[model samples]
Target: MEKIILIGDSGHAKVIEDCIRSQGGSVIAKLDDRYQERFYEEHLIKGPIALIDDLLIDDVKIVISIGSNHIRKSIVERLNIADEKYATIIHNRAIVCNSVKVDYGTVIMPGVIVNADASIGCHSIINSNSVIEHDCVVENFTHISPGAILTGNVKVGQGSHVGAGATVIPGIDIGSWTTIGAGSSVISNIESNVTAVGIPAKVIKREGL
Candidate 1:
């Protein structure tokens, strides 16, 4: 079994730990800037984020268990680890089709369904029970939150967040760095760096405006 080092120690971390275990991998340690002691019922707390370099070994894989796309990207960049050293975890309970392609460092949580021809980019999160339909393209660092649904041919850009339970209709394009509010229904295209909310999703806030 491969030994993994996980970053972060919160609820999201716990879920990622379970996903790792389900895949026949063991979490040797959890590193977080906050807690100094053992993180809950899991492995020993391996001090702060600074300890990552010290703990890294030749065979040990690393994964960022944080939920925030920005923070996850930041941690990966800060560590400067090779792409091969990053672990891509998919819970055993996830239903990913044979044609789906998931890149490195991505996490497919329990109950997630990724259909045929869908491509999920590096370090993205397909959270619990989320559905990525056929031909969907989820770019790097994006988060498809728990229970979110992306219909066929939908495109979710880099660093975007589709909030929990949000639904994007077929062929909809969600731009980079955008936020789709929880439970919203997106029927049209959303531009970059904006927050879209409500039924048929409308831009409520744009970056710097």
Candidate 2:
């Protein structure tokens, strides 16, 4: 069995734990910033996030199961581990095409569909029931939330978050560190570091505003 360590303990981490078990992997530890170093359960141990490097032993793989894109990026940078040490988790029920390329530390949840030629970058999340059409580019540290749809050729930049149930039209470009509001329809290009909401997904707020 593959030994793994999860870097979160929220509901998101719980789902990831199940996913790992489905692939016949064992999660030996779960690290979180909120918890002290101790056993949380008979089969689980909670540890401080700062001690991640020390806990990476016995060829155990790592996954940052946090739902927030910013938090995932920060944790990854702090760990500074090699690419091969990160785990790429794909739920057994996810329908990913053979032509698709998924980088390390990316998680593809159950009910996801990644069509041909799609590229998902490192530490990104393709959440449950999300549809990534052909030729889409989902960059590093991004999250395509549950039920979101990225139509063909959409390019979501690094650290972006496509909110749940949001739909982006074909050939759209969503910039880096941006957020698309839940259930919104993105009809045009979204700029970086902004929050876009509503039917047309306009930038309602920029970073620090």
Q: lDDT of candidate 2?
A: 0.93
Q: What would the TM-score be for candidate 1 when compared with the true structure?
A: 0.95
Write the residue-wise lDDT of candidate 1 on 102-160 in tens digits. 99999899999999999999998899999999999999999999999999999999999
Residues 11-92 of candidate 2 have per-residue lDDT tens digits of 9998998888878898988888887666677577787887677778868899999999999998888888899999999989
Q: What Cα-based lDDT does every candidate model obtain? A: 0.91, 0.93
Candidate 2 to truth, TM: 0.96
Q: Give the 10-residue window scoring lowest on summed lDDT in candidate 2.
A: 36-45
What does the lDDT come to for candidate 1? Answer: 0.91
Task: State each model's C-alpha RMSD to the native.
Answer: 1.8, 1.1
Regions more than 4 Å wrong, model 2: none
